[model samples]
Target: MTGFHFTVLIQLLYRVGKAPTVILQPNRTVVYRGERVTLRCEIWGGGGTEWTYEWKTNNGNAEKSSNEYIINRVSDTNSGKYSCMARGDHQLTEWSDAVTLTVRLSKPTVILEPSGPVVYRGEKVTLRCEIWGGGGTEWTYEWKTNNGNAEKSSNEYRINRVSDTNSGEYSCMARGDHQLTEWSDAVTLTVRLSKPTVILEPSGPVVYSGEKVTLRCEIWEGGRRTQWTYEWKRNNGNAEKRSREYRIITVNEYHSGKYSCMARGDHQLTEWSDAVTLTVRLPITPTVIKQPSWAQIYRGERVTLRCEIQDDGGTQWTYEWRPNNINSPTSSEFMITADSRGYYSCRGRRDSFTITKWGVITLTVFNSHPAASLSVSPDRVQHLIDQSVTMNCGGNDTKWRMRRFTGSTSPSYVQCSNWGTMHGSSCTINRLEDHSGVYWCESGSGEFSNAVNITVQDDYYDVIILVSPVHPVTEGDPVTLSCRDKEQNLLSNVIFYHNNKLINNDSRGELKISAVSKSDEGFYKCQHSGKESPRSWMSVRGEKD
Candidate 1:
């Protein structure tokens, strides 16, 4: 049996063509839940033959043998890849390329018609309910609110006028034939009070002339997203100002008025704010300040004038002085050296701009004879250290005494017995020192002479240069160099040097360097009449970039 068991074998073969293709009836793979869909399988380019179709799904569901598949209600659980094949009598063709099907749940949403979530009171608003993936099915709508129990059946909810009680969260839901959609995401709705208030900038409504004033309109309860246009009325005037604030610069009496403001936003107008009144008055009058004395005074008597604002108290103030109806170069106070006589007036100022009314005062001058004149023996105002100097009071008076006014001390006449010898209306100092100052003559009748200033220089009276700002001068700053003796007496026809090299010769004994730089910094000195001064170091600091 094993040897002779060679049986005849016949091989069955089938000609194969292009693979089949699957087509969806609706041409769309995605469908909403509870929607009906049909998928049809087709075979192309195969020989004419009777065949049976088989279907497979990537979701591991059982296979079927139909050319078309119908789903009464598609759901998320039935979504997957689908394929089909055709089996003939002699052979089976390859499966078609996969087609994906996706199912999504329907969800409803609520949207505001005007887009802004915040609405002013007395404004009309609308809320719309919408459902996606419902497949043109008729749906019933319902709304829920967090603030109060509100029910509505239509797809849209209309609010004729919003109020504070309507401010809360809002949500919607839709119901179809087969299912009820989940509640949509909540949307917030705000209803705000649109009452506005008016305020004064300086708090106090009363202000002086030349002061600035501002009126501001404010809405306290409205949301920041609300845009507003302001309307302001002043003192019930017919004209209305369209601005948030009204400013008055250099305020005067005409600018004082009662102001009221109102706002309009979100298609609604707010109530007028409380009215506020402002008043502007003239500045306080200025007063003259000085020692009380007779309005009329004789010549050679010192005169001083000072001005003050009545309300200034101790506050600092600047003064503008007018002498004889002409502007004078004086501030806060004025000094008249016995030679001046005129009518003086002054105005007190705050911040150099706000000025008060001017205060006036008068002065008179009278000339007298037998006046004394002071003179120094050396003829020069400055004397060398330890050098004897003689002072004589030249006048017609027979009896006279010398008087001195030092540093900041008050003047008083006294005898020369303390520090010098008195000889025939003259005083002689054996050795001059720093104590020497302004000197004059006083007769027995208390008549005073013209004053003369004497400055005693130190032993090191050589030429020296003085710098306005000592060392470490900043770049771009002005610098001044002065040539003088040890007693600060300026010298003329002096030559200045930088780093031992001659720079320039100045007849005024002063050198000015505007906007100093690094090159201007070095050892500096001055030479006058073949005399050289001690060298001084100067440094310029550069600014940081």
Candidate 2:
């Protein structure tokens, strides 16, 4: 038996032996990252003398007795074509087929900083590509651009004084020993100048005492937005007392001074705008106020609200609630009144809706909630069996409770799992029975009502009405008119009914009734519903209750 080399291994795998020839079969290929790969080399001969097996990673002289060579954490570095040799000391030899392994890296990523997009031209822009982890050496960096300049570096590249020629497409490549990566996606850069400009204020200024206006700054030749602060003063006598520039809103008699502005640049202030003179004027000190400070009265209440406006920065101010809380020319106070519980407030109306404490004076006349009521369908003391009943509850938000008693000795509880249906402070529960006694609901804190009770009288097991169809049929159906759970708490599949007589008992679903027939209907449609009372409705010629 001979060892394996590229030539020797190829000859054995071609099967140049006799009948019952021995051949090595390899296991399937393709392995996942971090998983173990097992290469099996077994002979296909029917029978033969005991033969030795050899394994190798590549065509290296290294050989092992085991026909299987294992690789742990099968990464791309561990990938290649592998072959095996099978021999029995000097008896015979055989080799196995070769299999290829492909290693793929999770997508690589590039990271850049100065985070928020806006990258300026001529400014330094850095890009770094990072691969998860693959201890490598001897790397290459490549940069491409529409500007047609060669950009290559062992690691990184920097350009100074970037010009119009430096604008447009950009990309990079990372190459390492035995590994090659493609060029990254191209990024475009548009070069723009960084110069400063100006923004105009109002035309001739008769600047008001305390009025606020804006002076805008512009970049006559740049892509970057400029930030600026404004200053104002008179040009009369003291204009030379100012430094580079000054900013202000108000204009008093002293504000009769000259005014100009200065703009900040990347390095320093560019220059100042030509000085402009200003005149001064007095604007009205507008003020008005609202009373009861509101409108509209709530039920069971009389409503009153008022408003007042005055114009005198100084005066022993005394106010009168408006003309019937409506129109009042003279700045004075106003009045409002509410007969019942309502919302109203009063503020210093000397200034229109502005300077006033009207929100604080808001008062509520009365506080009352709805009634704490109680009622049970089928009467609170009636006996019923095999029937479906619904309980409707109303009045202010409330807590609910239901206790049960077999006779009058031991007490149990009636419970509901989950269902939130409270509208207009009303709740409706359906299907009440003997065990559903002492059912009550009450409002939460400050509800102004006591616990309200809902009664259900489904205690005794007796004759329940029998009808062909039930009241309030839900949607479409040839529904079976039948009974549910037995008196013993066991439920019954429904049975269908025609006219007032028993028909077929099958499925129970939506029930649809065609055109009415005098003989096709009857009073009292009943179906057994054990704990869930059977639903029954009487079909009368003309009557709905």
Candidate 2 has what TM-score? 0.25
lDDT of 1 at 313: 55
Q: What TM-score would every model get versus the actual structure?
A: 0.35, 0.25
lDDT of 1 by residue, 1-545 (tens): 47576688886856456667888856888767777877777877655877788788864654767788788878778788888878776767787888998876656778896689988767788999877657677888889988456475898988887778888999988777776777889889988676677888666666668777778898865234667888898888764758888888778889888889988877867778778998777877777754213333434333456776666255456777875323243467664433346667887655433557878776655454237767778654445666687888888897989877665444453457766899999999887665546566778887766555555555554534343333245678888777666555787787888867888654556888978886776667777788766565565555431
Task: State the lDDT of candidate 2 residue by residue for 279-329, as single tens digits.
Answer: 555543323333212232222221223333233344233343322233322
Misplaced by over 4 Å in model 2 are 1-76, 82-99, 102-110, 114-118, 121-123, 129-140, 147-149, 159-164, 174-182, 190-209, 220-545
**After superposition, which runs of candidate 1 have C-alpha atoms over 4 Å from their true positions?**
1-318, 324-327, 333-340, 351-353, 368-370, 376-392, 396-446, 451-484, 487-545
| lDDT (Cα, 0-100) at 195 in candidate 2 | 33
Q: What is the lDDT of residue 54 in candidate 1?
A: 79
| lDDT at 270, model 2 | 40
